[model samples]
Target: MDNSAQAPLQTAEDPLFIGGVGLKSRLFLGTGKLGREELIPEIVAAAGVQVITVALRRVDLSDKSGNVLSHIPVHVQLLPNTSGARTAEEAVRIARLARACGTGNWIKIEVINDSVNLLPDGYGTAKATEILAKEGFVVLPYINPDLYVARDLVNAGAAAVMPLGAPIGSNRGLRTKEMIRILIEEIDLPIIVDAGLGVPSHACEAMEMGAAACLINTAIATASDPVHMAEAFGLAVAAGRAALLAGPGRSLVAGASASSPETGKLTAFLEANAASG
Candidate 1:
């Protein structure tokens, strides 16, 4: 079932499930990058993403007007991410804030200690996932594609697991596809391709490779036309999935198909003589 690179696809009627929510479109969007707040609703309506990912940070409890949560539409399920946390404690604190802020009950847990480049600290991410899951939050830990780490997260009661393609903002395709494939095979949770996917093909490839969904931001928001990119990516994810279902030709050491001559076709040879116009 290898669908690495295949033809384009259009959106279908089926929906993918994320933590019991049926997403109308498998194309997941990130809310951190784009700024044309007016176009967000239109773009989301256009893109058809049921699960939208957002960052969770301090809300400055004093400033009653500091409500970042007001920007998103009510219909979409907000999956808050611990994008700026340096450790498990910080992530847990942010998760609490997110749970307080949003109406939903899920957190996309990520513990990135470094500022230069946000890389998930495996230890911190694992710890945060474990703690948050125990605390009654649907912890969706964004971590490396380590099968054992994923098993540990599942044991910790995580709702789902996210693995990166490269680093955030790198725009690189799946540099860890083999490891991710291992995770896909070994784990039972939904695998969302979280970061460094530059194009729709990347997301579609993730779906074709057996990932449940993908989280895309830099690619869509940074594009020249974000709305169109979103639509394109939506189609791409669907297309890749169709290919996965359609299946592909097997590769093996065997004789290929060989063409042969026609069996018998002399009956029509004299028909031209009878046609006297």
Candidate 2:
């Protein structure tokens, strides 16, 4: 099978390198909360996503028809996440299991015990990252937008730091924008804005703010039309990335700035005509 068709084409923008792998697409999709599992391939094709995250629990290898792995194309990189893990130990176990299942070495460390908020446990996450990274796993830990925790993850050898835009599955959209901005500026690793992105504009804003990528699942899955929403997100991500590369104009602090030059020939002519009149 020619799976090369499944890979997203590289754009004019530079590739996003993580764990020494160059990814063309900045939009990373998640295979959770989808109305139909069969839509995975279609969503990937629509979004042109190079990386797709899947919960370890969803991989049912025994049943080929139901297996999430079966639906995913070989060209796309699989990022198996430790979703149900509540502690560092459990997260390590899940990651190890994922690798054992031949899902590759890339793992998204998610240690969340809080059922109410569904927020990641930073301490546990860092610890797991440290362990998994040592074991040769490409670790991407999902965390709160905390500078200290990010620093810890860096020291722990994380390939990238994934901070939440808001509470998981809330679709609130970059509620922690300032904090994420801080991480982007401070952290040396790629800052992938994960969770709570409700719309294409939210993804665009994140990219404009210099986020390396955006991981969206719930918004696209629960939307009225998942495929269309995926394509919208894909375009939005590309546009935002291009805008960032283009070097957006600086914002004024108080007064509005005129688009036309203040001291140009046209301006002088207009001023003279007004004065003469």
Which model scores highest in lDDT?
A: 2
Q: How many backbone collisions does model 2 have?
A: 0
Per-residue lDDT of 157-208 in model 1, one digit per residue for the tens?
8888899988898989898899899888899888888888899889889989
Clashing residue pairs found in predicted model 1: none
Give the number of the best model, judged by TM-score.
Answer: 2
Give the Å shift of residue 47 in candidate 2: 1.4
Each candidate structure's TM-score, on Cα atoms with residue i matched to residue i, is: 0.82, 0.87
Give candidate 2's TM-score.
0.87
lDDT of 2 by residue, 62-143 (tens): 7756777788877888999999999999999999999998868999999999999999999999999999999999999999
Q: Please give the distance, in angstroms, between residue 234's alpha carbon in candidate 1 and its true position after superposition.
A: 0.7
Clashes per model (N, Cα, C within 3 A): 0, 0
User: Candidate 2, which ten residues in sequence have the lowest lDDT sum?
Assistant: 1-10
Error of 1 at 44 (Å): 0.9
